[model samples]
Target chain A: MSSATTFLLTTIMISFIINIAISLYGVFAKPSLVKKFIALTIFSDSVNSFAILIGFRRTPLGYPSIAVMPSPPQSVEDLKRFVSEAVDPVPQALVLTAVVIGLAVNMFLVGLIMLYYKYYGSTSTRRVKI
Target chain B: MSTLQDPLTGIAPLYLIAVAFLTAALGLVIRSNKFFKVFAIVNTAIVFAISAYIMHKVVDEGIQLYFFGGYPAPLGIAYEIDNLNALLGLLATSIMLLSGIYSAWYMNFPRTYLYYTLFLTLLAGSLGCLYTGDYFNFFVMLEVLSLSSYSLVAYFRDSPKSIEAAIRFAFTGIISSSFYLLSAFVAYASFGTLTMADIALKARDLNAVTQFSGGVVGNVAIASAMMIALASWTWTFKAAIFPNYFWLPDAVPEAPTPISAVFVGVIDLIGVYGAIRMFYTFFGQGSIALQFRSYTLEIFQILGAISVFIGVFLLLLQEDVKKFIAYSTISHLGLIFMALSLDSGEGISAAILHTISNSFAESLLFYSAGIAIVAVGRSINTLGVLRKYRVALAGIIIAMLNLIGVPPLLGFWSKYLIFKAFLDTGKIYGVVILVLATGISAIGYFKMLFSTLKPVEKIREDPRLRNSMLADITIALCVVILIAIGALYMLSPSARKFINEIGYNVIEGYKAYYAFLSSGS
Candidate 1:
């Protein structure tokens, strides 16, 4: 609710939306397959960032912490404090898996575009469209 | 652990996944075509038997949940076995088993080692998608299925058209699947758990199970709207309805014939299956999906109707037989979509039966066409060659009649149920949609089917076509299957009761479905 925090949050939110928009347009409109591939990477990365953001939560002390426990909780009070202070770990794990999948798909597509290039001598959809 | 999840029998789904890896490894180690053919066929038959055995267990014992890695529902992945998915599992394995035998001659082995590798992986991915209880897990399994299918669609790497279709298919597929991933994230963000049953429970009533989530979340209705909207885009694309229908015409013609059968028969049905699960089971009545969009289900009907119209008109113009079959797929899927959105148990069962029957008829047509195409070349104009092959001729006639929904066939009963379900729901326009769809589409069906009676301009022979005992047997098997299921419907009271029961469970079996989900924890 503080002025500085509000300013920071608004800026981050606006930029995230802008990034997603730019990446989407790139994927949809690019004439070159490789360019579209780049856009796809950014698009997936933006979604991954959103997934990571889903886990973000502020502690009672008004600071964000990673999903890891600060240390092994030795007491009930310690466990409760750790739970309240840390962000949710599940989305982070989900994002990790998504990242790996994105990499595999990207590599396969790049290889595919290369194959298409060999067959048609270009990666431009304009020239080699079905 | 639940007793139902206690046996080696519980690993029926896992066996397919492991076998897929085994097949992939075997391809690298062995170079013998005959060995791979027998091995693949034998493996598929065994899985088919296991699915049938476990399907009976599910029906008699109630819903079964098998936990992977022993980590209970919320923490680890789980597979939920129910009558609906059990039927799909049976469908998936049986179709793949039959396709294997058909492919024994269709695929040139040693050279097609990679094809079978991808084939088994596609099967595992489908089994995974059907059985997994986690929403995120569904996303992973869908990706597995899509990746293998993208490769298979471009199996003829020498052709630029095939590669281009594969590229477009891959790009569209990745983007659409990511949307599903986003839905899963939204669900996890809102429901505070990734387990599908937990999410369903939360969607219906958040306070019903307050144990897992003390986390912050969004409004259920708004969240459900976002999730359903995003997720259905993927389903529509997968089902090849409307705007997504663009890929099918291009992709189906380019792939080898058996892969074409896999596309129409096994792969497309999974899309309808996903939609049914998301709409009816995951977010059913009294959930935010109902309240958030006044016409969420109506959207299905409207899209279905347009897709049917578009598919039919296009089918009339397609010169390529494979592309014609692809358009027919769009029309059939649209009809299923309309049924799924209807207001009664009749709607759900009607959709399920149609999905089953439609896949059979469509695949049989493709298989029969394969025999002719390999001999005379791939064109509906060349279908005259089928006259010499009685099995292919019989296959085409029966499948076309069944697809056209001519009475006394298996396809007709499902179409009739869909009509009845529409009336039961008091949607008169549904009747208009059904009648006009069948009436108009039948012309295209006959135009193509009747081509077999016309004489060919010239004939070319492939020796394999003369020796296609395996394909002849496969076509006969398909023909027998279409007739048997149709006969059983009219003669057996149990058959009527069973299909009706599966339909009822689809619409109203949530309590039993709920218990299995929660039991995993």
Candidate 2:
């Protein structure tokens, strides 16, 4: 609702949009197999960014709380009481799981790509299906 | 206090999942010795018992929810159970236990041990997905299921085709997970919670942030929701529902026969379950006024319909038994999706029932096809003979009949229900599409059957082919279990009520779900 919170939200959304476009471009245009993997990484990063953005919060002093332990409030007048409510921990947990799974998928593919190179001596998927 | 939770029969879904998880962990460490098979079988047996316990609870006590660490509703993670999931959990465990037994007879020791571990892991992930109450946990559990499937697909890493299939599967898995996570994030941000009950509670109060007159949050909300839908679209592909289905038959065949059976039979069933859970539990029923109506529901319906048509059409073109069955899966899944999009109680119930029946039929088809291959010592097209291989051919015939939805088989009831649901809803066009699809499926199945049945003029007995006693027994058991269900369906109203009671409220909440989603509108 405030100007600063809106600004931070816009920044996160823009980054996410850019990452999505990059992944789309890779999916549609990239010829090399490894490039597609790189593109997938970029795509995953954007999703992770989206998760982080959901947890972004601002302090009562009108600045974004970069990171802090959400503490017990001393008084009702404490700005920290109003503004410093901890960001949703669920997204953080979700993103962590996604990153680990992403790593496993990447490892599997890298192994496959190496095998593909040995068999065909190329990384392009164009001729492989036929 | 622990006794109050009812330990033995009123077993939690998590305990069964933990049994699977711990079994997989144990197998990984001790896989070098012959003891691996014994341990794996024992582990699966334990999981089977746990699933049976959950099933008994559902049949007797109704849906059960367990919060980890004893946190109450709306605050802690909950494993909610009803008949739909209890049945699926039981079905998965039974199939896994049977397949584990069958694998010992049919599979080599080394591959058997490796696959058993991965198989249990995949089963755990699927069971977790079925029972979890939180939206984010659904996505996480889905990833656990998908990731294991990717590994299982690539288990035959020595083969290029298998590797390629695994890669594509992983790519699609990533896409689906992203879409699912994105959807969860948007729903959470908008509603300030991830629990389904809370989301439903909160959905009624919030309005879409409107800078102007229309209820749009500018570019922010649109992108978030689109990302979520895109993830689900990837699932549509993974489930082999028409256009995105090039991977199922090709990659699946390259895996060993038992693994292929689980992939098509159980794993794909889990994918369909994920879609239903997302649509009904997360998004509520189909409401056009909800944001992204055209993209989520309409586009999904069109995709589902196209998959039904194309799947059957493609099946009509395939002569190979496995490939034909693969296409049959796409067509059947299309019908399921059609029901899902319709979002009626009957439609959802029919889809759930159809899911189990299709899984049973697919397992029979794949296992039978494997046996046929072994007995003939060649592919179906290359093999010439029906009378020469009567038992294997009979297995194929029974499987084909079920796949084609011949009356009194497992497939027939589900098809009847799906068509009836469409007819009841006055979706005459949907019924027509289903009828036409079934017709084409019948032709496709018959073509494969006819190829297998072609008589050989001079039959040469091959000793190697005759040694497939284990494969024959496995197929016979699958057929018998399927037959047992047909009579059971005829004999019980309480049995029918068990399934309805579990999935009914999830479907009934559609109106409230839509209200929550459109409150801002």
Clashes of 2: 3
In DockQ, how does model 2 score against the reference complex? 0.60
- Model 2 clash pairs? B179-B231, B203-B516, B207-B520
User: Which regions of candidate 2 deviate over 4 angstroms?
Assistant: A1-8, A66-88, B1-3, B6-34, B109-111, B204-228, B285-295, B375-378, B382-391, B455-469, B498-503, B509-521
Q: Which ranges of candidate 1 are over 4 A from the true structure?
A: A1-10, A66-72, A128-130, B7-10, B210-216, B516-521
Cα error, residue B235 of model 1, in Å, equals 0.8
Tens digits of per-residue lDDT, candidate 1, B1-521, equal: 64346554456556766877777787788888888788778878887888888788887987777778776676677678788888888888888887999989898734666787787888878888887888998998898889989998888887888889999899989989989998898888888888777777777776765445553276877788888998988999988888677788878888888888888888887888888888877788666677644477888888898998998888888888888889998999999988987746888899889988988998999999998888887777889988889988999999999998877889999999998999988999989988888888888888987788898767675668668899998899998998899899978998889889887887787666767554534
lDDT for position B379 in model 1: 75
Which lDDT tens digits does candidate 2 get at residues B78-147? 5666666678778877777667666655565454555766776777677777677677777777777777
For lDDT, the strongest prediction is 1
Model 2 chain B is weakest, by summed lDDT over 10 consecutive residues, at: B209-218
Among all windows of 10 consecutive residues in model 2 chain A, the one with the lowest summed lDDT is: A64-73
Model 1 — TM-score against the truth? 0.96
